[model samples]
Target: KDSAEVTIKLKNNRRETVASITETIAPKDVLISKKGSHPTPYDVIHKAADTSNCINIAFLAEGYTETEMEKYINDVKTATDAIFAHEPFLEYKDRFNVIAVKSVSEESGTSVPSKGIWKNTALGSNFDTFHSERYLTTLNLKKVHDWLAGTPYEHIIILVNTDVYGGGGILNYYNLSSTGHKSFKPVIVHEFGHSFAGLADEYAYDWEEIPMYPLDVEPWEANITTLADFKGKWESLIKKGTPIPTPETKDEKKAKNKVGYFEGAGYRTKGVYRGVQDCRMRTNACKEFCIVCKNALTKLIKFYTGE
Candidate 1:
């Protein structure tokens, strides 16, 4: 992976700054240096009469070529349908504008460093981010924004053309996934949970005990918790007598369906906790968002749509 040396700086409102050279390295920024896609033909897949009141979502192509642009549009339709079939988004379908932007790529697939596979994709997306083989992501945020500069978009969803199971998202950033994967629908929705509603991953891995959430400090995400500020989270929704650090039970009606402070989240086996025994944020097996996630999602939707 041929990466370049780059520097970044942060500043306060008064313009006072702390200067430091952070070694931000990655695969060469191919997408940014590439020529722009002008006369960018697009279709408003879902249109609302009141643009000001509705959320704008654009589906852009990542690893598609000019010949595959039509197919990309169809893929966009599939993604739109997938998200709309679920809760919250389903209930408030009309309050959104879905646009399909045809940004053709020089090559037709993403890079997988572990597999020694690389291609000149539109967004420069690839697998093996942070040495996590399936963790697909693109650091070309500026290029992404540049591509959608003229489009009416408040949210972004970049569909990569691949069958490998990979996708990633960040809050208020973008949702990305592989359209060719079997878990396409669920993966996109799960990543959307991160990008749109600021939801955290409920799943945990004992192998990697990264202190992403300090036990003394509460997480700002709506789903997971550190218990330092438990009252600020979904405390109102928890029924009285429900045990804290809720134990996972064999009873489907009690454990899986109920909202309790289940330990193990944010990639840690301990110190972190999620609001439910199981949820879509936790696993693809649980198709629906848990009560807490749904509530947080609904609040965000209402705030945007004024519903």
Candidate 2:
């Protein structure tokens, strides 16, 4: 069935009906599982009642062989624990349902183009994305959706089986990361900040001499800003009397926790400004999302959960 009648309702905390509307919605087309099809197995890592009111996240295996499916589920649990370890997610844990999709690969590891290694993975995910050695991603999005057909998933998290340190995320699309990397926890959460809340990278490569944002126009991301429209971003969140271009703290720890308009984000050092000296979006150094990012994520969660 490609089209169906869906009723979207808004309810109050008291369970009172606030508003309701029904509309015709068409879902994306994909091959449904049949008796002859080798349907992939899935586990409900976290389940919620009335899934219509909850956010569903799918953790799909990218390079795990059939024998490694157990390890894949373990990875999903680890990643889930990492997510709820932070603020907002921990506070709103009941608003989510997590699933682990075990899509076996003929081989056990993803491709590393820089290393001239390729595997016949389920999704054909690989490193060296866009010439960046650490940017792991997949171009075969169709296969990903096909594998996830009939799953109650709104967000996609592809767990690639490799110890390589790399991952990437696109806004509202999906987040992919290496499950075996030491930085897996932080990398997945950082990528989630992108795919879940449309957050931008709060880091830059000044040495590259290429700007990702225009100084004359503000970037639409909730965290970083071009100062062209500072008020449209976290400008109001900056403490009174704080410097516009916030100065770095002498101590790295203090800097990571501080919230201010720190210039250096979106792959450019000068023009773009971020909400903190350092953030989960910036590096794996910080253990959690910065205040500005937390606020944005909180807002998004509330929107999703109708809170």
Candidate 3:
């Protein structure tokens, strides 16, 4: 197909010659491999809400052979249950549609490049992303999206079959997590906060020196703040008599669940602030999301489903 981009001409003014942009389209055959393999089928694990007006989360299988498809399905269920067990998701359980896309592979584990190991996974997931050993991700976005073509999905969770304690999440893109780890449930929930609501990482890191948020501008994430502009953030959630830049005192330790601006957040030791002293976003203690995170997630759900 070929089409010409046009510019509107007003009747009061004579038609002027303007630049034209052309769009070309072509049809290409989608050929299957000589091995006679095709895209795997998907299954609806949980249909709590209708596809037309719900947040559809599709879980894709990685590093799981055909024989382990059953296990992959069970892992998908565990992830689904773990996600909804949290605060905002628990309250809005009926507003989500969970699916499991069965993209089987020939191998049973992901690539661990640091250990000189490789596997023929369906999505080509690997560790040592950007030279970080624990950072897990997949660069095969086209393949992932192609597998999800027929499914109703806005977010993706790629469940790897290995027991390695590694996972990664990108905002509105995808979440990659291992299903067999003991901390998989809590870890997936933490990563989902990033991919689903664009929450910043509350924990500080010591290894890397990548600049995250600028001190002059307000961050768009609802969980962390630099105090650049706290007008629309969790400022309203702050309790009365709670001082700004709340100190980490004995009383603060006693009231660990309070919604005060605790220093040391967003992968920085200072300047940035988190809503609470401890939360799922800050650690893997299987804790509930802070009040700020819960409220933010609630608003995000309402934005998606009007519920």
lDDT of 1 by residue, 258-302 (tens): 777889998888888898888889998787888889889989998
Candidate 1 vs 3: which has more TM-score: 1
Give the runs in model 3 whose Cα sits over 4 Å from its true position.
Answer: 1-39, 206-210, 249-254
In model 1, what is the error at residue 273, expressed in angstroms?
A: 1.5
Error of 2 at 173 (Å): 1.3
Q: What order do candidates take by TM-score, descending?
A: 1, 2, 3
- lDDT computed for candidate 2: 0.86
Residue 199 error, candidate 3, Å: 0.6
Worst 10-residue lDDT window for candidate 1 reads: 30-39
Number of backbone clashes in candidate 3: 0
Across 1-307, the per-residue lDDT of candidate 3 in tens digits comes to 3344545433311223454454433334245223214535888888865667899999999999999999999999999999998998998888899989999898999999999999998999999999988899999998888777766789999998889899999899999899889999999999999999988888886675345666666677899988988888887878788876787755744556678888778777778889888888999983788888899999999999975
